[model samples]
Target: MFHVFCLGFLCCSMVFGILLPVYESYKAVKTKDVRQYLRWMMYWIVFGLFMCAETFTDIFLGFWFPFYYEIKVAAVFWLLSPTTKGSSFLYRKFVHPAFEKREPEIDEMISQTKERGYNTIVNFGSRSVAYATQVILQTAVKCLKT
Candidate 1:
């Protein structure tokens, strides 16, 4: 019962908090606006209702719907949830160009990446991890010898 409620809570939060924002970001790219609206408010209401469904499902039916209830139902509730395509499209089309706003830093990073590549960063991080692990092992071995 409580488990069902908890799952429902997770679903609602995922839908509202994570999914909605991502969707809005996508819409912003497609529509070129980041303004909040009736859609967001409606989703908030839907999340509340879904939470209620989770809490009372057991009471009503001795069964759990548990928020993966149905795509049709969720779609009806969500009424065209935001998709990621718009966002990626927006990033390539709009954002990449706007990073001109960070000209010097972007140029420096690109130059370093062209010169040294990702392997340099990865090799440095890996070397640090390996050195730390060896130091820890050597310390343990010394303590045992003592």
Candidate 2:
């Protein structure tokens, strides 16, 4: 029924949006052409943002929009179309400009996150080792008593 259409739409989107683009990106990388590589990199950045937005839209508004899948498929096709260069257009118009404006703030946030993540991991590791040692010691003592 409706679910079948959604599944088909997603499959088509995946083929055009992800799989084919990935192959093209690989070829672009192998050729060592900066222009082609940059083009595909733009596509990847735009596609990533598209996916994040789509996840929320699909969760909140998908059922309400009867033509959702069709529109999604068309959008993916547009993004991948060489003639349109939609991905490049979007990156230049939106993503690049926004990121450029916020790059410093973004970098600061990333640096703080990395520091916190490292500290958290170190803390977790030490706690885990301590717990394991305690458990082992307790088990050994119990076994010896028996």
Candidate 3:
């Protein structure tokens, strides 16, 4: 019974999350209006964060809380609600400020990570080629001997 209720709430959240965004996105494209685009951007950022949190917490608290899905769906609705404009409020009050403060640090970390990843991939590629060449040469020598 609890699982069934959770499923229903999940379906409702999906409908709100997917359908409403697509509709708003189409309007944004058709109108080519900056405000509409900004509104959707705010919605996406909050919704995305909510999804990441839900994914991590659901395993631990999903079944424990009876109101979990109910709250999840409600939160999604709040984020997308035009009258409430919860997303914009949250972004302005919290998300934007936090990100703005950390932007430089984040940029530096990202650059370092990218450089490390590139170096690792290059090292792996060179090592793989060398190993392959060694195997090929050894096989050729063995075949020639036989």
Taking all chains together, each candidate's TM-score versus the true structure is 0.28, 0.95, 0.90
Clashing pairs in model 1, backbone N/Cα/C closer than 3 A: none
Superposition error at 52 for model 2 (Å): 1.0
Best by lDDT: 2
Give candidate 1 misplaced runs (Cα > 4 Å). Answer: 1-18, 21-35, 62-68, 71-146
Task: Tell me how far the alpha carbon of residue 58 in candidate 3 is from the true structure, in angstroms, after superposition.
Answer: 0.9
The clash count for each model shown is: 0, 0, 0
Error of 1 at 84 (Å): 18
Which should have the higher lDDT, number 1 or number 2? 2
Question: How would you encode candidate 1's per-residue C-alpha lDDT over 1-146 as one tens digit per residue?
Answer: 65665476468657654586657746756775544444444444444444466567647643444444343235333433455333334445654467667889989989988778777888899999999999999999999999
C-alpha RMSD values across all candidates: 14.0, 1.1, 1.6
The candidates, ranked best first by TM-score, are 2, 3, 1
Tens-place lDDT per residue, model 2, 1-146, is: 77987998889988999999999999999999899998999999999999999999999878898788889899998888999999999999999999999999999999999999999999999999999999999999999999
> Which residue pairs show collisions in model 3?
none
TM-score, cand. 2: 0.95
Q: How displaced is residue 70 in candidate 3, in Å?
A: 1.1
Error of 1 at 109 (Å): 58
